[model samples]
Target chain A: MKSRDLFKKEHSDEQSYVVIHPLDDQPEQKKDLSNFEPMKMTFTVRLSLIILRVYLISMILLLAYHFLNLTGIIKL
Target chain B: MEEKSNKIPDRVDQPSTVIRTRYRWMQKIMLFLVVFGPGLIVMEADNDAGAVSTYTQAGAQYGLHMLWVLLLLLPITYFSQEMVARLGIATGKGHATMIYRRFGKWWGRFSVFDLQLLNFLTLVTEFAGINLATSQMKLSPDITVPLVAVGTIIMVLTASYRRWESITVFLCLLDIAWIIYAIRLGFSFEKITPAAISFFPSGQGITSSYIFLVIAVVGTTIAPWQLFFQQSCVADKRLRFSDLGYARLDTMIGAIFTIIVAGCMMIVGYMAVHSAIGYVYKNPAQMATSLGAYFGTIVKSGLLLLICNASILGITAVSLSSAWAYAEVMNWPTGLELKPKQAIGFYLIYILGVLAAAGLVLIPKAPLQLIIMTVQVLAGIMLPSSMIFLQLLLNDRELLGNEFVNRPWNNWINWTIIIGLFALSIILAVQVVLPQLFSS
Candidate 1:
């Protein structure tokens, strides 16, 4: 038995929503990132995102510094 | 493969009709059972191979002194995961898709790439753990690693979502054996009470070694993959807004049980400390062997089997998260319900992840130490950032709406957790990069 047929037999129920993409030419629900609207960057949201960016950069820099320090590339 | 329903079941107004009856309590219980898997599996699977070693080492070195830390972490774990459950139930989308859709391609791509790299590295460590555990039983990695790898793939490929979840949940319950084993090792409530109450190890103060181990415990408990795994799992399970309370309860129960099992593992480690040959710090496999020398074969075999089980759980959950996130971002078909023929890209990602990790572990001169160190640093970096994304997503009023958007108090608590996790991640990074810094 082919897996496509098996899938058809198995999902021949009210519970076939599990197939986000179909084997047949049924309608595509577009369960990907297509349907949702992108987040509207309000003032507070932009500030929060900036803070997150700063935090990530600072942490990554600190890690790099430590790595270089451990490798004897930089002192102090 | 025709989909009768266009979306994963998002029926928010269910079970209300089912509960308008004399058997409301029974109906509620049944509803709870339906919403149970994502939370419990994520939590138990969080206690992966790395966690087992960390807890056991804490026990061996400090006895029950660290029980308070685990206790402190219970609420933190519950709140963090509860928000994830809500987002998953509300959005009906995976975390990666939400990030990509909302945060734009740059940040989205960054998250997806980091998650794939970190999850794959972590999976390798899990397979290494399996090899180490089986070595205790004189089982060769050549045979066991590939066998378990194939088993994990088949487990996912051959089952429906519900069946896969049921099997995983049953495997999660087997950790109860650790609790029983802890009891058999002679842990009494009276014996652990004082240690549980104490905040720090008696007579050792706050040494760098102790601090490092403490940070390690924290890092192990809450990981980035967990954020991805649970949100995707909740979506995969198709939980609805009506099931939010039950899902929260499920997450809470999972958090409590995972911590208890971790505490039991710590007890096992503490008992190993008193063995005929006193506890010398080493890997869990050695600890099991040493304990077996005194307690007999059951101690060794039970610990090894449990470690192997932990590895299997870790591999499944971690690999699935990677697959789901990657496929979601690529707009490929994704779900356990889909046959291999139906969702080739998704299954390929999952299978390749398992096989690659397992194969790496089998190679004689694999650079496992470097891989482990990189995993640590990447995980340390990834965990806090993932939480930040989750926090922002949970707050998106447009996405979750007023009904599901986070309350102000949730923001406060989650921000606090993110900060605390940031500090732990930094400490972990330092420990990895400058090991000498923690030697004193």
Candidate 2:
């Protein structure tokens, strides 16, 4: 008997049956996506990265300044 | 070789193969039902506890003059979510995994770190909302918080992806109560007709406080956790390329539904403002209390129930986003379809997040207001950066190929939206830090 058929027969019931298709025989356990090449940082990509850093830094500084003022550590 | 079975399974649990339908419309409908859950849940879940507070507050303070903001956000919300769904369908990977791979280690780690931190803080707010809502009903947080925490954990651990999605979708549909409650509170098309298109303030003229409120509405509408949640959800569902059209429709429907629910919450606020009682409450629960005193217990209980529902939905989606993102980056087994043992790290993260947030809410004197402030600031920092990555990924033909890559027009609209979001983020940050600067 075919393995799929035998496995199905064992799990089958009066109301429902498990369909073990070829695709379901060995389900993917875990994915290792480390092998794919990272995107090349072209000038546009590089510039976007630079812009992101600047944006993040400025936001954090603004937050720090606000905290200082809130705590009365800074008058201005 | 065994002949391949041509039977399509309708329900997730039932393993029956049915004959293909003759009618094309029938087939299309079937296909749509299969692709429905993620988009609707994410969008409805967006109207979580914090959203209830923000939208209700907007209506109470400004009336329906701010309805145009929600209308403007409809297209923005749909377009941004459509891209995230497209990426998930195309790449079969979570957002965190995509960032880790495409952006290299430093940026990837930074994105994940920021996402986890913000999501954790947001989860705390969800629990706090739960506590507030339940307290209105004389239910102590000591009992309600732990009960809710355990319930959230059990829902995920015991069910398959399909069953869990069904339960979440049911909760999403329960938002219909908002519309019904608004009607009971005297909402009508006649009242909203003027506010729908009016772009100016009514009660208060455009001040720093007005701008601050506007920014809050925008920030609430388009959150950073949403991107992580929907993408991971799409990937977990294993949607095919053919399902993309249905997924987009699903997202559009979700966006519309969320806006309506949000608008109804605002109506509740608007009614309170117009009422003899007036609008003097701090949060949704308080608003419910004051309104309840006038409108009766039904209104109060209805609002509290809606809050608990929203918080539960938020708790599920937010914690799932954190777990899925963390697992994807760590390359652990992920997906709600897997048994708990098979996805130990993923399930553990979800449980830990719920417990930690609920536990904090239970602490007598925990600075939850401070945490909420920090969440707003971090969300301000996080949203723009996440969008930049999303835009970059969608543009990368090398990653998504021509079929999935953003067209020229898409680039134009998306970039404009991202810049607008960045501006709003800056406004949000400044508002958080220097309240006096934006003080009326």
Candidate 3:
């Protein structure tokens, strides 16, 4: 009876170890990276982008005029 | 591609077995390859058309007097960029995001605004160089400008970040010809080598002109966009704290390459053939004209190719920096990993930048030389502001943890650089705007 109980206890410990680490010998698993980035653009973000675009276009035009003036195409 | 596996171990326990160790070795090699682009690309792109003109002019007009400046910049560049690499790995975020989160939205917005404006203006110079080179080759602006614009857009749009990196790296390698050109010129090292070692200043007039050139070299060598671009690139590559050593190695290699290219450029120009004009290095094309008179059309062809390559490299990196900063600030999906259709706002900003810059180059009879010179000078004026922010962020313990704060020695070097750059900028300003005070 003593020998049987010792064997049972060792087996139970092994089982618990396996439970804790299911793939201790496994080499690889494909990572699930989906849903890491949100799909929807928030309203505030959309608004900021629009404002940025307007500012960008205005600057481009202003830059063009400045270049032309420097080159003598337009005497600013 | 950025590694998805770096964040996870293959086996939870006993992951370091012989076979797994081999696998991990391969993984480390791949990670290094992915992290390699931004540093080298940013460094080489610094050797852009404006930079070419400035360095070549320095050599031809000033001789090896400025060679010491290039040599000194080697370490200065390395330490400044090293902090960027550390920041990115520690935070896994772009410079813009960190600045915004840590320094308040107002400061963040100011930095971004400054970056975009300077980037846009700088892009003008790159396209201007492209226009000049292609025009000299008998390729009209109408054909060359649009084609380059389309080609740049397509290159960035169709490929992943890895692919774009490969293409730019290949283009940057073409600069090796400058070294060969220097060798062929048979640089009189017996004459200039001593001066180069002695940190001689080449004694150009101590007027605004000389100070302006000094500032231009510093500005173009350590451009502001480089800081942002490298940080974003580090985050995009998914670097972790463990990769800091390799990242610093990558940056060191870049700094070495940057100085070598600049050195070769100066050598090629120092020996350029010129008359009573006294080694005139007014512009890259003008320098080419003088060199061609002595060395034949081959000099022109070589100069044009180098300039064009630098311009294309600049356009891609600068526009990407803009797109990255804008997207990060607005909380949009970012990364070349995403499909264009998915990252519409991000990609749109990039395309807009390229097209707008190219379009400005199409302006009738633009003052190309004036524009390039002005842009580089303006860049020098604006660089100290960016460095201040970088210095602040790198020293922030809350952000980087205790292991990575600037050591006392590092702080000393940094403060010396900051003080030196600020002092020069101030002196240049006073000389330019209030010359009478200096004259007195």
Q: Pick the candidate with the highest DockQ.
A: 2
Error of 3 at A54 (Å): 30
Worst 10 residues of 2 chain A by lDDT: A1-10
Model 3 chain A TM-score equals 0.46
Ranking by TM-score: 2, 1, 3
Question: Which run of 10 residues does model 2 chain B get worst, by summed lDDT?
Answer: B1-10
Docking class of 1: incorrect
* Per-residue accuracy of model 3 over B166-186 as CA lDDT, tens digit each: 888888888888888887677
In candidate 3, the second chain superimposes onto the true chain B with a TM-score of 0.88
RMSD of 3: 10.4
TM-score of 2: 0.90
Clashing pairs for model 2 are: none
**Chain B vs. true chain B: TM-score per candidate:** 0.94, 0.95, 0.88
Model number 1 iRMSD:
12.0
- Tens-digit lDDT track for model 2 on B1-440? 11233343233233453213444465567567777889999999989899999999989877887888899999999999999999987877999999989898898999999999999999999999999999989998899999999999999998488889999999999999999988988877887566453776655457876688789999999999899999999889877565689899999999999999998898888887777354585889988888888889988898899999999999999999999999999999998889999999999999999999999999999999899899999999999999999999999877777788899999999999999999999888887887777776
- Candidate 3 iRMS, in Å? 15.1
Docking class of 2: incorrect
Interface RMSD of each: 12.0, 9.7, 15.1
Chain A TM-scores, one per candidate?
0.54, 0.54, 0.46
